[model samples]
Target: MKSPENLLKSFFAERIKGLVQSDIRRMSRECERLGGINLGQGICDQPVPDSVKEAAKSAIDRDRSIYSKFEGIDPLRERIAAKMADYNGIRCDPDREVVVTVGSTGGFVAACLAFVEPGDEVILFSPFYGYHRNILSLCEATLRFVTLHPPNWSFDPADLERSFTEKTAAVIINTPSNPCGKVFSRQELILIASLCQKHGALAITDEIYEYILYGEHRHVSIGSLPGMEERTITLSGFSKTYNMTGWRLGYAVGAAPLMEKIGLLNDLLYICAPTPLQHAVMAAFDLPPSYYDQLCADYARKLEMTCAACDEAGIRPLLPQGAYYLLADISGLGLSDDKEAANFLLGRAGVASVPGTSFYADPEDGRQQVRLCFAKQDGDLEEACRRLRGIRTARP
Candidate 1:
């Protein structure tokens, strides 16, 4: 075999280079090995639903293992299109309007490669998902983001407007967002949609957690607004809602012209998502609405447990509106660097959490915050609370 150095390629793509293995997974594995509770990544530690697993089994049993069609089989595409129109009121032609991807992450990568060429400007919000920047960077887009409004972890339309310029190619908006878990209210969506329209920029949304919303926080698709459907690439997947991260199945909907290019990237990069997973996703969409209702209620319970634990421990969290993550300020702990503080917790206290800096383009903006995922089981949450309380009391 050739030497490892010779086997490697040159300094890789800038975006891919900036992307790194998540520290959340690293810390969580250590916790698991040490017999500790882990609330690190948003991946659900629960088993995949029997129904979807059955679908996968059925596909394999029938020997339907050929490479799926370039745009995915008609049933999957039709299911996605109808579901989009039903839930978000955005009607799209199934054949020409959707692309099935390996996961929402893959869909975003394909979207960026298709629409955002080298040097194109892509905007996102701070405390956003790390992969958003990873995908943008992979496509060589100049990254821009608006910092979250303090304490509430909400957005200011003015800050969003200021970020826009002629060089802008697209804006990525996530509701029921990661880190903060703040769902963008309809008014927020309207303002963002207006700005995108005013500037003629594409709006690429990561709506993977749309179904886990709580109380009054409705998950609004930017494309649902008048005239916005044509310019928006709406992304979603079964990873979170169906607890199928390993399934690696997601789909995106947009105008035919935009989707055609995304399809090309999907063909070359992924060769269509795994066939059995696509079959499983079709099963996921057909499940009863009660499945979603129960999932949301379950997520709300976990959210409450985490917030109450934080309050009991004297840490302030700006109440998360939805999603499975919550952000906490670490300045009260007398630590200037949240990353350092997180490392300290990992090494000393056994609480694995993601330092917010890794998610933002400007590390300084996320310096004071850390994100904790609450998607673990109830016992895991209880154990984590006990350990965190011990750490908080012992810190000098």
Candidate 2:
């Protein structure tokens, strides 16, 4: 008795039935339709470093286009190992502990598949990245959310302690987090480390925005914390830092036993990441320290500009200690909810933003907020800012 559409839906797995394009992608499509400036998605449209471009060209010329070792090329893994030791303070073996992935998202998928199962419970901080939540859902793991209160996005230690129980299998941490931008401090990490050790649960961290910090915040890897070296899977990539998102290069570092299963999953899923791009990203590591210093300084300026624009539009910008996102309170705009606020910005200001409800488990938590990405190129960001500042004039 089913209709054709119902029959087609019945053919698909129940796990995927609820899935749809995220608000980030949805707003991006709407922005394209309206010829609006997109501040919704975290697409860093900045130019990739010239050295990295030349390296890719050189690799192509030398015909380094074959499938790489499933764990990635040796040289790239070595560079990642060295970077982890120096930057993240995590000592890892390139041969045994590191697996270059399609992207950090790929690594996350592999990790979820390798460890998570139907009965397992994964603890995620609320106001989480949508991919993280959805991926865990696909793995059929029960998710326990601990709320990250805004303005500062700090969570109470007692709440975190309660989230862990005998059923806990893993906890995902995204420092310099997306949407709100909370960098977990060493003291907080130590507490989390203690919980993981006590509950005998694994820790999976996403550190893609480790470099794009502002003010006095410092990046700390949970894997480097005491008693966590063997229990933590650390994920990061070249996309955000080196501005090569299209290249689809990233990596995972953890103890050999855990990485062995993740490596097998990576091979089964992706075969391998792009070969020539792996050779090229080595050039990114050679860039000077000044390059990183400049990266932070540039983002700090962009943050200031975007925050000022929001203030002018009567939106209260919640300042981030790190990352290139700003979550602004739109209560003063007289909008019903985040979706309305987002549409108002897009339709009137010619600037698109993601509804804040997209980031939380409970929609009401982000009812009056919208998240904006300031990671655009200077011209696009400035134009977006100008559009946002003119929003008052465009009000109905």
Best by lDDT: 2
What candidate 2 gets wrong by more than 4 Å, as runs, is none
Candidate 2: tens digits of C-alpha lDDT, residues 1-396: 999999888899989987999999999999999999999999999999999999999999999999999999999999999999999999999999999999999999999999998879999998899999999999999999999997788899999999999999999999989979999999989999999999999999999999988889999999999899999999999999998888999999999999998889999999999999999999999999999999999999999999999999989999988888999999989879999999999999889999999999899999999999999999999999998999877776
Give the per-residue lDDT of model 1 (tens digit) for 1-396: 857775574546434655667767666687677665566677687678888889889988887788998778889999999899888788999999988998998899888888887887778888778778766777788888888775666777778989999888999998878878778888888888888888889999989999988787788888999879889999988889888888888889999999999999899998989986777668887789899899999988888888777666556666787888888777677876877777766666677777777766588877877778888878878788777777767676
lDDT of 1 at 121: 77
Worst-scoring 10-residue span by lDDT in model 1: 9-18
Which parts of model 1 are misplaced by more than 4 Å?
1-22, 29-35
Candidate lDDT values, in order: 0.82, 0.94
Query: Backbone collision count in every prediction?
Result: 2, 0
Best-performing candidate as measured by TM-score: 2
